[model samples]
Target: MDISEIAITAAMASGFIAIHLMVRRLNFLDATPRSGWLSFAGGVAVSYVFLHVLPDIALHQREFADGMGVGAKEAESIIYSLTLAGLAVFYGLERAVKMSRGESRKAGEGDKMGNRVLYLHLVTYGTLNALIGYLLLHREDAGAWSLGLYFVALGLHFFTADFGMRQDHPEAYDRLGRWVISAAVLGGWVLGLVVDLSPVLVGCLFAFLAGGIILNVLKEELPEERQSYFMPFVVGVLLYAGLILAERHWV
Candidate 1:
């Protein structure tokens, strides 16, 4: 990586760490109707996935086909299956947390998730954060502008994620979870600096991330309890999608 890439990635890392460390301070997101900003952030993240990530998956499919000497159809199926696996894995994790929390409540332990659930949740997201860090240096398009766009979309996604995490395990998340995940982000970036992964591996990771992003965003936005703002979400989708198209055409 050049000096500029280093600088940008460092900033991206810091931004992610800050979201974990500082998300609780953003009190407005706690509103009953749900914050427009969170909805807007969700929309931006989804737009990035559809407009940027899905298209990139086609490129990765080509890489996978070449690397494995497989047919294009077979490679495409493999890439998409990984995406589905990513979504299913996180969905299962979410179910586990909710079940744990429900069991705890039944036992008159209030709304807290059990220690096992808390640990599992933290470890899983920590790994995801690390993957984010690693991909900072190894994304499909490593241009400065691409890095900036990735940071913006994922940074906002982190806000919604942090909020949900805090909701799930208020005490545990505040005390220890955020720190662990924050360090994971930096740890993954460091791993990227030292370890060179194959293009096929990176593509697999990207596909997984795309699935996770879709699940996380929808889980937050689509629930009836959230009362998410539709107008802001629509505006976010239109604006960011336009920006991406413009960038592709001109930049």
Candidate 2:
């Protein structure tokens, strides 16, 4: 990547780490009090998928079909299949982690196993951040304003992810989780600079990311423990969705 691309990536990586660290410092908002913000963040993320990413994926799939002389419907089916597969993969990961946790608890190794699960989850999330960072470089030609908006949306999304992880593994997240994800964003950007992905591969990455975001956000919300504020959640959805739509029109 050139200096401009490197600067853009660095800004994004800095944003990721800064927002996360700032939120972590607010220890008073721990546990249930954080739910409203988490809900709002989830709404914003899910909106991005419905309004922005999914449409792009559809176009990419259509292009793939045309290039290969396949039926449009068939290509669409494949795209959705990949999305479902992505969802299933993360769901399986959660299930496996939970199962291991239960077994560990029974075996009197609960603390050790919990730490292991937290490590794995953080690493996986960090890898996802890296993927996103790397992908941002491809949008270098798309203008600065669009790129800025992308970082804004993603930085907000990362705030929620940080809060959720901290709630789940407070000590470990404090000790290592934050740094891991922060580094992941930078690492991913570096990798992106070194590698150019094909359209098909890019589509796959987005599909998997969309699925993961949907799953992770919802998983945090559904638990009865959250006591999330419904109105704020709806407001978040509308507010962020409007911003995204307005940005699209302005561009």
Candidate 3:
């Protein structure tokens, strides 16, 4: 099998194993930390794309990418562009969506997971995960050192994101959500290899997540009665926002 197949299979098996453990171990599963971690897994998947793996791919490809220089400056420039574009578009959509409802961030209010919003979350999260997989697995052009570093970064990011999220929201997890998220992340990672579109597709992933984040931000402004399972996603989106903004304006 090729790299894609290997990556897909490993992700599925591992994710499933994680899910199974959650199901067997947790009682009153709905209030467990599993869901938060699951939600975080998705975020971690996306972060792997945005923070480490994607940049390495982008930098390596830049050399042959329309004659772009294979220099740190060029890599920084590309990351900056994606970051700015990602954050700007995210906030813009958030504002536009909020305008219709006269929304404001009142702390603890939740966004409605309307069909549009749910679809936004799934597609964006999937796309982000897929795009990263595409660049990393397909870019046979990358060296082992950078690739190893990228994987290390991905591992740490995933671990930290999941742990922190689990700590923040002790009530969001359960066996059902745990399996669902575990399946989603692992399955999503594997599927991403197959649906591997292009580097440009990564941009679409960011855009999709940006829309969902905007929706979550709107929800966060609502009254307590309206709160839901969206805060996890909102937090993930915010992380992406921070990373992208930093990549663009700060770094």
lDDT of each: 0.91, 0.72, 0.43
Candidate 3 colliding pairs: 29-174, 35-173, 105-221, 109-222, 111-219
Question: Candidate 1 lDDT, tens digit per residue, 1-251?
Answer: 67877787888899899999999899989998999999999999999998988888896677789997999999999899988988998999999989999999999999988998899999999999999999999998767678888999999999999999999988898899999999999999989888989988898899999999999999999999999999989988998899888878888
- Candidate 3: tens digits of C-alpha lDDT, residues 191-210: 65576655544533443443
Better of 1 and 3 by TM-score: 1
Q: What's the candidate order when arranged by decreasing TM-score?
A: 1, 2, 3
Ranking by lDDT: 1, 2, 3
Higher lDDT: candidate 1 or 2? 1
When superposed on Cα atoms, how far off is each prediction in RMSD? 0.9, 2.7, 10.0
- The stretch of ten residues in a row with the least summed lDDT in candidate 2 is 138-147
Residues 47-151 of candidate 2: C-alpha lDDT, one tens digit per residue = 777777777788677775875568888877777777787677767767656676677678986433365667678778887888878768864225676676667
**Best-performing candidate as measured by lDDT:** 1
Candidate 2 stretches greater than 4 Å from native: 66-69, 104-112, 139-141
Question: What is candidate 2's TM-score against the reference?
Answer: 0.85
How many clashing pairs per prediction, in order? Answer: 0, 0, 5
The Cα error of candidate 2 at residue 54, in Å, is: 0.5
| Poorly placed runs, candidate 1 (over 4 Å) | none
